[model samples]
Target: MDTLITLIRWSIATYCLYFLLNNYISYFYGISLNDYYQWFMLPSKQAEIEKLPLIFSMILFLLSVVFLNLLLSSIQLKAFGNFETYIYLGNSSLYDAHYIKDGDSKVIVSQTATITYNSSFKNIGLTQNFVSNSSVTDGLGKPQSAISMGNLFASLVITFFFFIPMLGPVHALLSPMLAETYTAKGLNVFKYQWNDSFNALLALKGFSLAKWALSWVAILVLMIYCTFRFPLQQFGKRAMNLPSYIAANQLIEAVPVSIKPIYIERARKPGETQYFKRIETSRRNVTFRFDKDFAQSVYVTAIVDTENNNLIEDKITSHINSHGKMQLKITDDLGIQLVKY
Candidate 1:
């Protein structure tokens, strides 16, 4: 089967990359690959890898992903759909182009017809260093969600240095959370007045049992959060009682739709720090976060029809309230804010 063959070749290619990078990536940071592997990748190295300068450290992180994509091409593996397919299987085909001709457009479609599109992406850049005024809170009133280069790479960097000791398989299951924290709260260092990266690494050696336990709890919680995920959609149940607006077709209809914090991330160029941009698909997950002390505002986007998209302009507004004790204000077009208690 083509699927099985793809997987086989993909695995071989990825293992090759791992074999190469696992031995050399740390070299870019002027650190020992073995120490990083044993201390951080194996036992969450108490921030030892952080010893490298921050920018250089992030550079190494960035290069590892860049190289992974580059190596994928060497194996003749091209990703066709979502990253979940080729990423684990080793791939270079995620970026693609196609010429689609409408069956009925032959009147104007000939060999001379050509179309071009120019765009950039930063969806892959390291975000643990992106300082922002945004925030998200978990059920326990703990805010834990925000934008990032991606959870996958974020965890990859984390597992290489900070995850609790575990087998390769276990690390695979828990790496996403490791990266997310640094990505979302990378600024926590500035916001909370924590020590620098080097001290954090040194201090981690004495992390209390409670801290270790909390780390695992955080990982499990993030896993469960996305477990029942759904796409960020317009017609389904969202925005607290949104389904009430659905028509007989069980879909929400709007003349114009715009979602604030178009959070998938921007596309980027090499050497410019990039993050993964999500290709259009029916699958998506929406996360509601508190930008500040409360849910100050929520963004809504709907596509009633073609030829209409108004996000930057303020044509609509909304609000959210619960338990009668507090109400969250929301501007229809912008994200919530981040403020101290």
Candidate 2:
């Protein structure tokens, strides 16, 4: 039973770790593991998936560190146990001190004699002051015992599944908007006092610096692994079996024309562009009518037939003299054509 419970715990932790890693890679690297693998399989898209600029990548790395710090700090705060409770015993003047004779020492006898104290004084004022001072000291001094095992486990589960995996990226993206909102509501986010206040709160919550450092190391290691592992794997595969990869792409392109999917698009507006999907057909002329307006000029962006295959222009420009009626003549043999007026 214990082994089964331990296995279940490890399984949940592993799953949460994978979930967080996947989200981190997807957000920072612009692709997930599965998507990266699929793209690697397709040789055509290899050049299209460009690496991010160095400066932008550095900025993302810093942002991820900030987000991870915030997440771990919040979890630590929530998992920390409450401070020792202090009961008010009225004023110091209410209780009278009576000295009780021991063999060699004298002890104060009072209604609260059972209560522990640093000294022989029975004054509630001194006790209150001591408790207040010790509370602050203990808050930062002892963090390991400040958190219970059960609460830490629960907090970890919530942090991994919900906070880090789901809301981490969203918060990072919307942080600027949130700051503006706070500023509009009279809370200036750029102020240094807010930083001090946050530090004080962390101290009060018994945040462990050691644990935070360890978390940073772990996150950095994981980031490095996720960033390079797939790219290196792809490079190795291409270098090793280049012919097989090329053959796979060629095989995909050699699919039968009759079974190939056909896509047809029609213009909703007078000067809208139209795309004619590639197909194998006999040479024939096809006519189309623009019911809305007449086109003065027809700009063919691309035309691909059995003989002539060329992209006329890089971009399509709508014709200005589109008025009463328009007619279009397109050869049916043009396998792929893009027309605009």
Candidate 3:
């Protein structure tokens, strides 16, 4: 319990430091505070989603700063050859009787772990034991670097957040939880002095939770803003509108002629008055007879409907042969009949 608290406190403090520098201090660098507030605290405005380019750029800059900090700190730790170790017990040992002992012959009635190491050198499969003492002295430094890197990564993660939108907050909350679990388990295995202090620091978990909550609120505001301020007219005109030139001439040149009424010959089974139209059998090949008296080309479309009167197929398309008249072939199930649009 104490270890859990310590990890939470450490994670929260680290997160707070990053948040302050990125949001509070970095505001002087041309990014508007209002926009930041909207991004974090307000709902999205559709009309303003396009304006996100600026905010995205700012997030990228911050994430870069974080990455640099994490890189430098990671290099520093690696140079010192510090690493963390853990213990795993055999099935029998984990479940069997155990004893706790201190220096000399002092025994305690509490759960404790026995620690050992693999042989440094083996002779013909024979072994010896030696302990490794390398430890990560700067615990705070590693997490500080991570927080810095995450600040920048969070920017690139913004758009993708819509998919697994809760990842950021989930990550923030889990940092301390994971740390606490590992630290507590480590204490049972080895006499790592720092574990006590580390667990102590993690006790204050409230702040980390607060940071997650705040970030979530900010995202909600940005989404609301995007919805309200969307530029619909510009998109409709450019992407959705039919060309004026095509509409004026295309509709008139195409008209149906010599319409034939098709009939259902017989039902496939008793009480099945209508056959179900299938996608493959609907359109039999069309036969065309051309009239040289008509100078304009006719674009023909075939629409087939099911016995339930539902539109099974309606395709507006044309194919021109060497003779210059348009032809269209449609195929579907027997239950389908033609309709004119």
Candidate 4:
């Protein structure tokens, strides 16, 4: 229980440090604070979150500075490193943090993660979710649209290129703070100690939770500002005006006169073993339409849904031949369907 509390405190503190800095200078830089903590916003304003007022923003910044200073001075930074090791979230990628103890079975194993999110469930099968609703449409496993899937892939790229690239320096800067924290706690510097300061750990844990809660409130205010002040006009002009633009502009031309070589893919949710299969058949719909601007080329999309898996994927190369040919490649083993996507 103490280890869990420690991990939560460390994660909250790190997230806050990232969130606070992003929210603070964003006002002066004319950048949106929503970019970092948009997930902290209300559901309606998530995509359109905005800026913060200078006065309120300054207050939050000062508070974060004070809290961070206290945490660093108290050796909470080392506590954080120990907490990371405790939770198995450690890595040499961030810092060369080596905490070694002999003859201990428990060891921190560092691993990374990939985040995937689907915004809508447009083509998802009805059976995917136990109960379907208006907001999410279908269930958790529902496949994503091409554009939404693009966003998911974009997020992965950002995690690697943006976060990974910056974390090294950030980790290095924060590492020195551990010395002050150690001195305050009067701990052995040469040999690390643990499980001795219950009261101090509890106090830091409470404060970290409080700090995290207030950060969410600030995020909510910024989101409201963003939603109302969003530059929708410019986005609509460049990205596409949706149903409105469809009515105003010429209709999509050179639509697929005919489609051939109908291909179907089906599968059940994966089981403990790869060979496991369900008795029921699976259904899928592959759809296509010419691009709004380009008449000759149409974008192809496939909605893959089942009791076990839901996914939206596209072909790497989608060029209908000059002779109006639809080339769909399939395999005998239905599991091949899972591999293609």
Give one clash count per candidate, in the order shown.
28, 2, 42, 4
Better of 2 and 4 by lDDT: 2
Q: Which digits, one per residue and each the tens of the lDDT, describe model 3 over residues 1-341?
A: 53564465455544543464345323322233343444444354333333344455445444434534433333444454333221111111121211111122321111122212111111001111111113423211122222223433443234323322323322232233334444666633112333333233333432343454456667666545543443211100111111232221122222222222234344366676558432343332222222223221211223333334333222222322332333322222211123342
Candidate 4 local distance difference test against the native: 0.31
Q: What C-alpha lDDT do the candidate models reach, one value each?
A: 0.28, 0.31, 0.30, 0.31
Clashing pairs in 4: 50-226, 74-181, 75-181, 269-308
Candidate 3, lDDT over the whole model:
0.30
Cα deviation of 211, candidate 4, in Å: 5.0
Report model 4's TM-score to 2 decimal places.
0.22
lDDT of 2 by residue, 108-133 (tens): 33332222211111121112111111
Tens digits of lDDT, candidate 1, 1-341? 65665466566645654555554323222334364444456455454333334445445444444544333322232223111100010001121111111222211111211111101111111111111111212111101121122433333333333223221222222233333444475523222212233234224455443564566667655544433342111011112211222222222111211122223444775876546665443321111221222112212222111124343122222211221111222223321111110
Candidate 4 at residue 85, lDDT?
Answer: 12
**Cα TM-score per model:** 0.20, 0.18, 0.22, 0.22
Q: Of the candidates numbered 1 and 2, which has the greater TM-score value?
A: 1
The true-versus-predicted C-alpha distance at residue 210 of model 3, in Å, is 5.6
Over the stretch 1-341, how does candidate 4's per-residue lDDT look in tens digits? 64665566566655766674565324322234453333234475433322232234444444554444334322432223211111111112222111111223333221211111111111111111011112332112111221132333333232223232232232222222333444566743413321122222324435332443455555555545543443211100111112222322232222222222224344545554534444434444333333344212223233344435433222312322342323332222211122233
TM-score of 1: 0.20
